[model samples]
Target: MRTFAVLNQKGGVGKTTTAINLAHAMALRGHLVTAIDMDPQNHLTAGLGQETHPQVGIDEVLLAESDLQTTVIDARQNLQLVPAGTRLSEVEQGARGVKGGLLLANEIKKLERQDFVFIDCPPSSGILSMNAILAANEIIVPVSSDYLALHGMSRLMGILNHVEKRLHHKMTVWVALTRFHGRRRLANEVRDKLVNYFPGSVLKTPIREAVALAESPSYGQTIFEYQKRGNGSNDYSALADDLLHGRTR
Candidate 1:
């Protein structure tokens, strides 16, 4: 199984949106996928249409209060969810000052086989984010088509560098442009600049800025189930295809 962390220190950059849709889209492609929300908000749980709180979640698993086997809930037929609780902050603080802070790496190994595991990291460089960085084999950064968003990408790269040195895990990193506006010249410039900046790290599939993507979450559905022909659906499909064949290209 391959593990990826959808992370960005900046908020409103479509990090949660990508994690939710990509997890569902991969499951649609007949892959066993699990999404773990490291964020305390528990947005990933709600995005998957789950309202009832699970008895055990990532917080308990990370704290060694629960095992990984019992922490997972079958979100769908092929998609599973390791739900996050509002008490994640307490769980993180509880692990403070411990050696080998990569608790997530140990928990993830218990799941014998799965196609992919996506982690939705919190928008900070706290202990929770450190565990995600240490656990992930790959990191995908979602940046908006704005100049200010570029700064977040650079900051995250620095953090990833630290993860590699301290955690001793070399990560395969990719940068994806999210909420892109095709008509704007500045957006086009930003996209081009990002490609120039990262070179091979840039994914060609850019998620267009679409209202359907924004509206679908309220009904607890992905873009595919919401409006199949919409831009949001098309872009996410492209993203899934790119993700599946990423190792090849």
Candidate 2:
């Protein structure tokens, strides 16, 4: 199974949004998908239309009190979830020492059922993010089309480089430009910059700015379920195709 961490240290850059939609897209393709909500805020959990699992969540699993299979919730047809709870913040604080970084990875070894796993990381370089990195073999970075986003990229690049050296594994990364306005000069400029910097790793289909994407989560639905005909749906579907065939190779 391919484990992809949808991460960005910069907040409000559509990290959870991408993970929610992309995981659904993967499931639509008949892949057994599991989304791990590593963010303490549990945005991905709520975004996927789930409340905190009353019995167990990622916190319990990370603490070694529960296993991934026992905590996972069936979110959709082929999509499952390891939801996050309020205690995740406390768990993040306690994730210290050598064992902390590998906590999620150790739990993940027991999950032999999934075909694709998408981990939603918090927008900070902390223990939660560290766990995401340790558990993932691939990463999907969703960045808005702006200069500040590039600044975020620089920091993320450094973090990934450091993690790769530590783990001794080269992770496959792909960049997805979100909130793109095709007619805007600055948006086009940012896209060009990303293309030049990332080369073949930047996805061809950019997620256009759409009200539906923002509205979907409030309704506890993916764009496909909330607005089937919108640009968001088409773009995210295209992105999944890109990952499965185009850029991942």
Candidate 3:
């Protein structure tokens, strides 16, 4: 399985949006995808059109109170989810040692099913995000076009580097430019800088700043089913294809 964690310490940069849409788009392409909602908010779960059932979430697995098999809930066709819940906050506060950070990774290794696993990480550098890094084989960073968003890349890279050195994991990193507008000069400049800095690791397709992406979650749907004709749908689908086929390579 191509396990990836869609993460960014900075919130509101479309991390959850990318995770929800990308997973949906990948499933649309006939791949069996399992999206793990590691965030306490359960946005990915709700975005996939599944209600956040109480007492059923990553908290159960992380607390070692539930079996991995019993935790998975089916979403749309070809997509499954290990949903998140309100209890995640309690799980975070309770789980304290090195074992806590490895909880998600251990559960993931035991899964005999799944072609792709996308982990939707919380917007903080907490134990949950650490677990996502430890569990994933690669990291997909979704960044906006603003200059302030540019400042966050170094901090994110620093965390990954620490994980690589201390944990002895060799996970790859891919930086994706999101909410890009071609008509804006600043957006173009940011894209150029990102590609220059990231080199071959940057994805070719950029997600346009589309209102459809922002509105889809409200309707409990992905862009594919929400507004199929919009640029948001098209770009995300292309990104899903590239990610599935290893276009970054």
Candidate 4:
């Protein structure tokens, strides 16, 4: 199974949107995908149209009171979900001195038959985000097309380097541009700068700024289900294809 954590310390950058749509797109392609919502906000859960809360979720699993298999909800034919609740904040504050960084990694190992696992990390550095990075073999950092978004990437990379040294695991990191407007000169420049600096690490597709993406979660649907004709759907599908085929060029 390929484990990816969609993360950004900066909020409102389409991190959850990327996580949800990518999982949906992969499931649409017949890949067994499990989305683990590690954010206390639970936007990922609601976006997938899951109103029913599971008895146990990431909180219970991280606390070692419950396992992932028990908490996983069947989201779709090829998709599974591990929803998060407000108690997740309590777990984050208390998770310490117990090798908490590796808890999620241990829980993930118990899952079976999943082709892809996408972890929705919170928008801050904490025990929760640390556990996510430790668990994930791959990292997907979704950045807005704006200039300040570039600053966030530099900081995150430093953290990832520290994490790699501590965990003794090399994570494959990729940067995907979000909220991009191809018409904007700044957006095009930022994209090129990312590709130029990162080389093979940057995906070619940049998720364009779209109202459909913002409205989808409110309607409890992914972009593909919310508005197939929208740019959000097209961009995510392109992203899924890139991820599946490794067609960076």
- Candidates in order have lDDT scores of 0.84, 0.88, 0.85, 0.89
Instruction: Pull out the clashing pairs in model 4.
Output: none
- Whole-model alpha-carbon lDDT for candidate 3: 0.85
Please give, for residues 37-103, the per-residue lDDT of candidate 2 as tens digits.
9888888889888974464789888877777788888999999999986678877788896579889
Sorted by lDDT (best first), the order is: 4, 2, 3, 1
Q: Which ten contiguous residues of candidate 1 have the minimum total lDDT?
A: 92-101
Residue 62: error of model 4 in Å?
0.8
Off by over 4 Å in 4: 52-54
- The alpha-carbon lDDT assigned to residue 239 of candidate 3 equals 90
Task: Show the lowest summed lDDT stretch of 10 residues, model 4.
Answer: 48-57
The model with the greater lDDT, 1 or 3, is: 3
Per-prediction RMSD in angstroms? Answer: 1.7, 1.5, 1.5, 1.3
- The best-first sequence of candidates by TM-score reads 4, 2, 3, 1
TM-score of each: 0.95, 0.96, 0.95, 0.96
lDDT of 1 by residue, 60-144 (tens): 8887788988878888778889988667988667777434367888889888779999999999888888888878898889999
In model 3, what are the clashing residue pairs, if there are any? Answer: none
